[model samples]
Structure formats: structure tokens, C-alpha cells
Target chain A: MDEKTRRQALKAATLGAAAALASPVAAQMGGSKAQPGGKQDPRSKYPKPPFKSQSQPWPGLASKMNPRPDHGDTSYVGSGRLTGRKALITGGDSGMGRAAAIAFAREGADVAINYLPEEEPDAREVVELIRQAGRKAVALPGDIRTAAFCKDLVAKALAGLGGLDILVCNAARQQSIPSILDVTDEEFDRTMKTNIYAPFWIIRAAVPHLDPGSAIIGTASEQAYNPDGDLYAYAQTKAATMNYVKSLAKQLGPKGIRVNGVAPGPIWTPLQVSGGASQGKLVTFGATAPLGRPGQPAELAGIYVRLAEDDGSYTTGNIYGAGGGQGQP
Target chain B: MRLPLRVLTAGGAALALVAPAFAQGPGSQRTREFVSASAQSDQFEIDEAVTALAQSENPDVRGFATRMIEDHRKTSQALADAVSRSKLAAPPPGIGGDQSMFLSALQSARGSEFDRLYARQQVLAHHAALVTVEVYAASGDDPNLRAVAADTSALIQSHSAMADQLAAKMEEGQARP
Candidate 1:
């Protein structure tokens, strides 16, 4: 055989090997059990979670969910990724904010968590958990929509945590409007202020204090990319958030502060349960993604950690999609 | 005699043809089976959690729970596929071993009682899960498992707060009219 023919045959064999390795059935031929002495293996009986749908809103609170979402406890190991660093997370009472807070703590960063007055209990619990993890956690209660409040929040976080190395803009409120026509000007303004403008202010206030190598991460949404007519205002603001991340990355990159965004497909968080979307539309949430399911906050926690730490140092001006294949890469 | 000779020749050819399958890799079959099993186990737990949440009476809880279930389910499938290809054993189910009891207790309660019990269990479960994730992340050799564990740990921490909030709300609602 000619040299070219031999090379072609080798290439085909390599491709065939790779294809066999990539097959789904290849997974089944592996281990039959996860661990010894644990509960009976659950794979034989239960159906997997379905993919996310464009119309679904956030899934609220993780504790109440059945079978429970994976939250790293015994699995995450700290490598001092953020040793002596400080961070402030808005809407840190519960949900994605809380998850980010814990990840920061695990990485050796001190955190100051902000929540509304009514969400004090939720915020306090997270603060305690942070403390238990051997980090200092400060609980600040206020609304992020107010410029004065945002300023105060930054001040308090600086005072309590000393200085900020990372700023996670994660607080937002959502309400479902039947149509764009049904959305009141007031509602649209409110959503934008809370979701978009608040982050802008927080980043602005926090910028001067941020040192080189600092990072800023905004929690955008899958809705930003795939807009539903009903979520016009919320979706618009989220899109703005994405744009802000891109623009800010360019602006902040010069100062050694990286700006990025996390666009979650559909996550279970308090924002969803507390009227982010109308309850009437909650039941069939996360039903249409290619993966056949929505995602949990726990599932998303690692991406934020990676983004904040050195693991994602080279990554900026990028939006990490944790939406379970809902948004294509 | 001619027919017998032909049958023997056919048998010899068949053996020769199939010999490469057994010679492919040592312990490859076992490893693949293990990974597949582990993935399935993870999916089952995630799915069960979602279904339970969807059926919940509280609209708020149900909504949030449904999302968690969906996300976990998707990740679990990906993990399952990975495990199957790796030929590794699946992780065992019920890390703390009391999920059944908790589920049963939850099933027996009604109204606010059910909510309280469910929320409390979530907190406990997440706390335990966090520990498991931490250990796996630190010691597990598999990059995928470690990544999943690390990410899942952060999420569980968030869930712990949500569970506590729901529990508090349930208590408050019970106290009120």
C-alpha cells in the first residue's frame, strides 16, 4: 500500500476508537455502584430531570426540592485560590448569591453578604455558614436599587471585610407581564434599576477600591439571550447586564480587574420562588432544553468559583453558560 | 466427514474473529460498567428530587424544587455518559443513608408540618452533601468528578440557606392564622 493509504487507514481507525469511547453506552459498562454501605443505588428506578424550557422562570429554594440538588460540602477542596481576598455579594440571603458566597469562603476569601431587610434571616444563615467554614462573613441588609444604599453597601463591605478583591453583582427582581403592552413603565424601570443600574453603581463604587487582579462577575440569565415575549422587561435588563459585562471587561481589563458574566439557563433560587415569575407558570418550568432539564444552583456554583479564581484567569469578557445546554456554545 | 470438517473450520474462524474483542484492554469492561452505573445512580437521585418538588403543595417550594430537579437531572445525565465511557463504577446512592426516612416523614406530614420537615431535611442533606463534595474534590482522581463536586458544593451551600428560609417561613405561617 502507498504511504497515503496507510495514513488514511490509521486516521479512520483513530476516529473509530474515539467514536466508541464517546458512546453513551460506554458509561453503563463502568461501575455498577457509587459507594459501599450507601442507600440502594437509585439509577434503576427513577427518571432523570428534564431539560429547561425558554418560558420557565427560576426555581426557588433548594431545600424544598425533592431528591435534592448537589451542593458541594464534602467534595470541594480549597487551594487558597483567594487567600486573604475579600468579596461582596448582593442578594446573598439565599440562592445563587449564597452559593457564590460559600465558594468564595472555601477559597479563603472573606465575604460581606447583602440582602433586603425582609431577607435578614436567610442572609444571616449564609453568614453563619461562611463563618463555620473558617471565614469572616458580614451581613448587610438593604435594597440595591438605591444609589445611596449601593454606596452604603460598598462602604460597609469594605469596612467589614477590609478591602474587596471580587465584586459579584447578583441581586435582581422579576415579575411576569403577560405582554409588553401589559408591562407598566414603572415595572420596566424597576426591573432595569434593580437588575441593570444597581450593578453599574455597585461596580462603579467598588472599582476605586479594587486592586489589580480583582474580578467582577455579574449573574445574567438565559432569558437575556433567549427572550420570551412575557419577560420582555426582565429579559431586556439581563441583556443589558451582559453588554455591561463585555464593556466593563474592556474598561476594567486595563486596570487588571476582569469583568465577566454567568448566564444560567434556569436555576432554582429564591428570586424564582418570591414572584420572579408569576406562579401560574411555575409548574412546567425547564422542560425544553436539549439536556431535558433545568439546572440547580449547586450545579452552577463551580463555574462562578472558576471564574473568580485563577482557574479562569485568562477568561474575561466571556459569559459562561450554565444553563444545561439551553444556550449553545 | 466432509460436513464435520466444514463445521470445524467455521468454528475456528469464528474464534479467530472474536479473539480481538477479549484482547482489547484489561479490565476495560469493568471500568466502563462502573462509570455507567455511577452515572445512572446520580441521575436517579436528581430525578427523584425534581419529581418530589414538582408534586409539592406549596407553589413557591414546588417552583424552586422543580428547577433544582431539572438542573441536577441534566448534569447527572452528562456525568452518567462520562462514567459509562470511562468504564468506572457509579457512585453509590444516598450518601448519608437517611433519605428514605426523610422522604417517608415528609410524606406523612400535612400542610405546614410537611413544609417544615421538608425544609429541615434539605438543610441537613445539603450540609452532608457539602462534606462529601469537599472530600471528593480534594481526593478524587477524576477531573470530571472533582469539578462536579466542587460546583455542587457551592450550590449546596446556597440550598442550605433556602432550606432554612423555608423552614422559618413554615414556622411563621404555622404561628399565624
Candidate 2:
């Protein structure tokens, strides 16, 4: 195309995207949702696909996301499944972490959340949601890549929430490098430190404080079983997490503490736009899922809440999947 | 890094873009400056890509050009949203500072000359963006902008590596007298 033609093409492309975005989302599939921050019916099916591929900066902002990934602000309908519990959720700023935070708080748990300093906006939002649940909420912002920070985060969570009955290693980082050669040293280390190392650090620090009946849920992924060729490091760490979760479940079971993993499929989250998936992959994300659309954060909150409560009293060493029928068991 | 918004998020010095606007009065101005600089870079790349698509027959250059247009458009929208929320002036559509000269040179070039020129800027711009976003991420006055800068820097670092490889290949092709 010539300059004039190319300019016209780009102009059309921009306008087209803007035009589509201008259309308002029809109220959630089953009807308009209750004012967010409160509960609605648990079975209300939210809208699917046609979500904006908007990316926020690192540790991306949930608020900025177009049609923001619903963090169970509505449609959760907590049933006091976890009354009087104290929980610490890393990466509770957004995505599954945010959803679980909301579920836990509404289920009657005092909550402490740790996330990257960059995610403070999201953490603040989560804190507000938790406070709305009539539960104590504290935001502990810092990097999870360092052991010192991980230990410090646990201490702060313990201090803020009084005692921690649920320790969720939910924070993670991933980048798609197609070729092994494209994986840089810094990139590899960051993936490891985030997806693997931080879990170890947080678990080690929290183990001493955890009593029997405490739940340690690590956010392993379906990638552990079905690895993506581009996400080499991420898949590797996720695989390792599956093993670690099982091993912890066995070890902690002797102490009445349960360890488990949740393998989420292509849940729509800031993680995708933040380089969790290659851009091309994002163009058709979650299409192959049994369900045509990607899973939302709200879908996973109930499971997290269950595992942390008496509902999961006997569930340990199991990898519960919210993977939309992809990786079962 | 929208400083005014960041300040509001940080719960201090709300939107006070007073005189000495560029000074460190809680980072709103600095955030605006960062956003403007980033917008300038995005526009420069988009213009260069448009030139490449129009003039270059090389499939590689065209592909890279397509990517630049798409990537910049998405990011620009986000930045535009930030600009709107910040109530800051939207940056004019052009290159910043001496970058206009590069855009001019790109507009006039053709064939391998255009290829070489485009790739060189890609290399340089990617590197500059990597550094700029990294600096802002590390110590930018605003917390929110710092996150954007950090995310953008990671992306730029990836793009820079690709541009570096392309620059080397284009330079090799240019050597064939």
C-alpha cells in the first residue's frame, strides 16, 4: 500500500477498534449484576469472549482493564464458608488472587494481601473490597522474587491478620519466548524466582505459624501438565509446583495443614497482556477450551474458598482444576 | 506514569499541576512528561512503519511495519485513556525533539536504503525505549507510571533484541556492493 493508502488503513483500523469498544456490554448474561462489592446469585453466567485485549503496565492494573476481569464483585453469594479465618494471599491484587481475596473476605475471613509495589492500585482495591466484607484487610506491597521480601511479607501478614490459616502462593510471572535461544538470563531467573522461588520462601516462612487445619494452596497451572512450547520457563516452574504441592500436602498433612494446587486454564487476567502469552496466542485465547470462552477470575474463587474452609477438610495433594475441562483431576 | 493520578492513588498532593509544573511536587508533571515522551515515541514508530509499508517490498520490513502499527495503536489507546483521566493535554501527533529528522529521512527513502534507515531507527528507538522505560520504572516519581514504564520496558527490551538482530542483517545486506 502507498503512504496515503496505508494511512487510511491505519485510520480505519483505529476507528474500527474504537467503534467496537464504544458499544456497551449488555448487562451480564443472566441480567444486570447487583452493585459490585456485594453478592448476587452464584449461577449467573457472565458474558464471554469479545473482551478487550487491553494491557496494563507490569503487575498490571485491574481497574484499567477494559470490561475489567470480574473479580467476583458480584455473583459470589458467600455462605459464611470461612467465618473467622485469617488468610494471606500473594498476588491478591488481581486475577485469581483478587477473586479469592474477595471470596475469602466475604466468607468471613480477615485478609492480608501481598503483591508487587507496582500493583498497589489493585491491592488497594482488594483491601477496600475486603473491608466492605466487614473483615480486616491489609495490603502488604513488595516484590516476591526475593527471599527477604517473601519472609517480610509473611511477617506482615501474620502481624496484620493476627494469625494465618490460609497461605496462598498465587503470585506468578511468565513471559513467552518462542525459541530457547530467545530466553535471556534475567528472564529465566525472574520466571523461576516468581513462579517457583517465591512459593518456597513464603511457605517456609509461614510453615512455623500455620496450625493444623490451615490450607496452603499454590496456584499451579494446567501448563504443568500441558506445557506450551513458547512458555518454556513458565511450564517448567508450574510442573515443579505440582510436585511441590503434593510433597507439601504429604508433609503438612501430618501436621493437619493441607497443601493443594489449582490448575486454571486460559482464565482472562492481566497476566495474559503482561506477556504471559504471546500476542498471537492472545488473538484466539481460550477458543479451544471446552467452553468457548476463557475462564474468569470469579470462577476460581469458590474453589479457593472451599479449599481454605471445612468444605475441603479432606482434600489434600489434589490439583483441583478450573481449566474448563482441559486438564481434569 | 500519570503523576497526578499516581499522587491521587498514593493519597497525596492531588492534581496540583501548579507553576514549576516540571518540578518534583509529587510527580504529576513528571508523569505527564513521561506519558508525552512515550506518545512521541509511539507516533514516531507508527509513522516510520507506515512509510515502510508504503515503500518497502521486503517481506521482513513489511511484517515488522505491521507489528509496529498494531502494537503502538493498542498502547496509544491505553496512554490516551491515561491522558484523558489525568486531564493533561494530549501530545500532538509527531516525533519528539530531533526525531522529526529521522521521520523525514524515512519518508524520502526507498528500497534497501529505506530498509536500512527503518531498521536503524528500530534498533535505536527500541534501545532508547528500553532504557527510558527502565529508568522510569526504577525511579520514576509516580508509582503508577513506574508500573507502566516497567511493563513497557520489558516489551521494549524484547523488541530491541529483535531490532538488533534485524539491524545486523540489514547492515549485512547493505555491505553487498
Candidate 3:
């Protein structure tokens, strides 16, 4: 058998054995299970790519995806890790931001989410989910490309949530181009502004309001380390994201505020279907990972939860990765 | 039940507010303890708010009491359903000892005094309740109970913020002509 098939069979055998044996070791493997002894293997947990060649406008909607990206809508069971915390998340309508938003609300936090106005349909779904979780949800729809709006976004979030303790700068712009020659200055500037500049502005405005125990999380990517030629501009911004996370963590460490980053690899998000990946690449997306599948946004929910949780007081200047056995490149 | 002992301050007679304690550390709360505490907390809020709805002339205090009743009832029912599903025995009947004492203190007051006391008690009660749910949600033994705790935490938080604002407004009114 080929490596992928063999691995799948091995995983299936292990799962079956665990079910039959009901061993303590098997029980221990049930990470994040709603109940004990309810283990599900990670490899087969979510949708794999061989995705349809789909496209959306500049920003995409999670609701419209063929295999809707899971944002822990039902699967994530939060323990009151973030009770009474207030959060501000960019791109909270979809992807990692959406997953974090859902998780935060479930963990007992009031959340303010920002997205493009076009993403209202998706943002509305998130708002409803947050409210259903019984937390306050503030929806702020606007472009992050402008420094003015980014500053306003934090101010609005503070006003809406009544305070701020968690800030997740997860919104990003990625458009894969075959060559640098085809990359326009406007596209580069857009990527830089959305990925780098916006965080700079948002964090600047938010830091003054953040108390000692507050946390700031940035969504970096695997492309930061192993630069994809097509994602030249995007990759560099991710690297910048990682760099800033480290730099700021030190700067903020003494004040007791934590700064961290999540570097996701080959996760199935709206970013992919919306010009973030070429059609050919989209079909085989995440196939290169050792797991032979793309990841769902839900998989990274715990990492974000941990980074923001009070228990992670000692964990700062860190970049937690969920790259599906691909490691840090 | 013993009322929170009222003491005369240098400026005026003030109700020495006795803050309710959850009696459990963070992440170590048991399922039974969680259910019992949650049910009691909800009952305390609902019962006190019911009293406030009748006694308070201030619209803000009355409105807040109305919301507390509506929201706490939902959380109370949700906790009961979760307990039923788990086949855990029902939590002890009625509110806790401390809650009963505070309720008595609230009952003895009159007019604007009652409104101020109600607002203050709600803030303290919700703060304590927030901790109880948070501790259980973080490290409770039962998954379903934890989920309930987590979900309820947000509402408790919102209520806490509202109570703070209401208390501040009341203070402002008292200070002004």
C-alpha cells in the first residue's frame, strides 16, 4: 500500500482497537472529546482537498464554501476559560477568526468581530452564534486596509464590549500569483496593509486599553517559513507577523500582557477559495501534508483558546503551529 | 436569617454589603457542586429581581430586575435539563444559606433604599456567580455541566456590567441635586 493509504488503514485499525479494547491509553487519546472515551482520529476528522475550483470576490464567505469550513460551531466544547473576558477579532466572519470568535463566546466572553461589509451574510451567522452562546456580539464591518479604520475598529470594539482583554489580529489578504512579474504594486500594498499595517495600527490603539492580563494573538502562516514563490508578498507579510509577535511579546511581557501568534498550515478557509489560491492549487490543496488532507479552521480553536486563557500566563513570545505533521517547514 | 449588619458611617447610615462567596477554587469544582451552586444562584437572582420589580419605583432598577428574571430563568432551565440528561440528582431545593440571608436584608429595606440595595446586591451576587461558573467551566468533571457553565458565564458577565452601570447611575443621582 502507498504511504497515504497505509497510514489511513493504520489509523482505522487503531481506532477500531481502541473501541474494542476501551483501554485507558485509548481514553487518553480522546483529546477535546465532549465526553471521556469518545476519541476521534485527527487525520480523518475534517474535509480533505480535491476541492472544486471555486472563486469568490476579494473576500469570501464560509457559508458559501462547498464543504463548509468548520468553525467549532458544534464540536468545540468550551470550559469557562475566558468567562467575562472581552475580545476584538478581525476577520471574525470566517476562518481562524470565526473559530476563535465562536470558541471565545462559548468560553464566556463578549466578542466584537470585524469584517468587510460584503461579508455581512457570513458575519451575521457568527453574530447569531455568539448570541446563542449567550455572550454579547458586536459586528464591525469595514476594510482594514486603512490605518484610520483600523484605529476606529479598536475604538468601536472597546465601546461595544465595554472593555478589551483579548485582541486577535487574524484577518489577512492573500492572492497567489504565478510570478513576481504579474504582482501589481496595488496588490502588494493591499497585502502589506491588510497583513502588516493593520495589526500595527490596531495594536497601537488597543495596547493603551489592555490591562496586565490581556492577550494579543496574530494569525501567522506556514508560508512565513517556507515561502511559496507564488505567495511572495503574502509569505513576507506572514514572516513579518511572526517577527512582530516575538518583538512585541518582549516589549509587553513586563506589563503582564501576552503576545502570541498561530501559524496555520494548509487549513481549509475562505482565504483559499477567494483568489488566495490558484484553481489548480486549490484542487490539490493540503494534499502535500503528510496527513494527505487540508485542515479545518476548527482544529486550531484550542490553540487560540490556550493562548488567550489565563492559564497561559507564562506562555508569550510563542508561535503555536498546527501544520498537520508538516511542522514549521 | 441574619441581615447584613447595618452600621452607621461617619457620613450616614450605610448597609455594609456582605459579598457572597462561591466556596470553591477555580478548576476544582465538582458536577454536583456546580449544579447546586448554579441553581441556587439563578434562584437568588430571580427571587430578588421579583422582589425588586414590585418595590423599586426607579424604571432602570425595575427594568434590570425584569431582565434578570428572564435571563436567569433560561439559565436555570438549561442547567436543569443538563442535569436531567446526565441523570445526576437534582440540586438542593431553594437558594443557598448566604443567598437567603442577603434576600432577607434586601426585603427589610424600603423605597429608594431598596433600589440602591438591590442594585448593589445584584452586582455582588453576579460577580460571585461569574466566578462559580468560570471555575466549573474551566475544570469541572462533567462535560455537559461545563458547557452550561461556559454558556451561562457570558450572560452573567453582561448582567455584571449592567449592574455596575446601574449602580454608578444610582450613585450619580444621589450625588446630584
TM-scores of the candidates in the order shown: 0.55, 0.59, 0.59
Q: Which pairs clash inside model 2?
A: B1-B145, B3-B28, B4-B28
Query: B1-177 in candidate 2: lDDT tens per residue?
Result: 566776676565544433563443333666767887898888767766766765578888888889888988877787677656555667644456456546534543445766887899899888877777787788877665666677677777877887887888899998888
Q: If the candidates were sorted by their TM-score against the true structure, best first, what order would they fall in?
A: 2, 3, 1
Model 1, range A1-329, lDDT digits (tens) per residue? 67566445533433333333333332332212211234422233222333232232243444444433333322233445676789899877666787788667766789998877877655665776577556899988887888999998899999999889888999887876645666788888888888988998898999999988899999888788866555778888889888999998999898988999989875655555555643322332443343434455655667778888866778999998876545522
In candidate 1, stretches whose alpha carbon ends up further than 4 angstroms from where it belongs are A1-75, B1-177
DockQ score for candidate 2: 0.01
Question: Please, what are the lDDT tens digits per residue for candidate 2 over residues A4-26?
Answer: 66445533443333233232342
lDDT per residue (tens digit) for residues A178-234 in model 3: 567778999999999999999999999999999999999999998888766668899
Give the range of the ten consecutive residues with the poorest summed lDDT in model 2 chain A.
A14-23
DockQ of 1: 0.03
Q: What value does the lDDT take at residue B154 in candidate 3?
A: 91
User: Best to worst by lDDT, what's the order?
Assistant: 3, 2, 1
Q: Global CA lDDT of candidate 3, please? A: 0.81
- Candidate 1 accuracy as TM-score: 0.55
**Alpha-carbon error at B66 in model 1, in Å?**
20
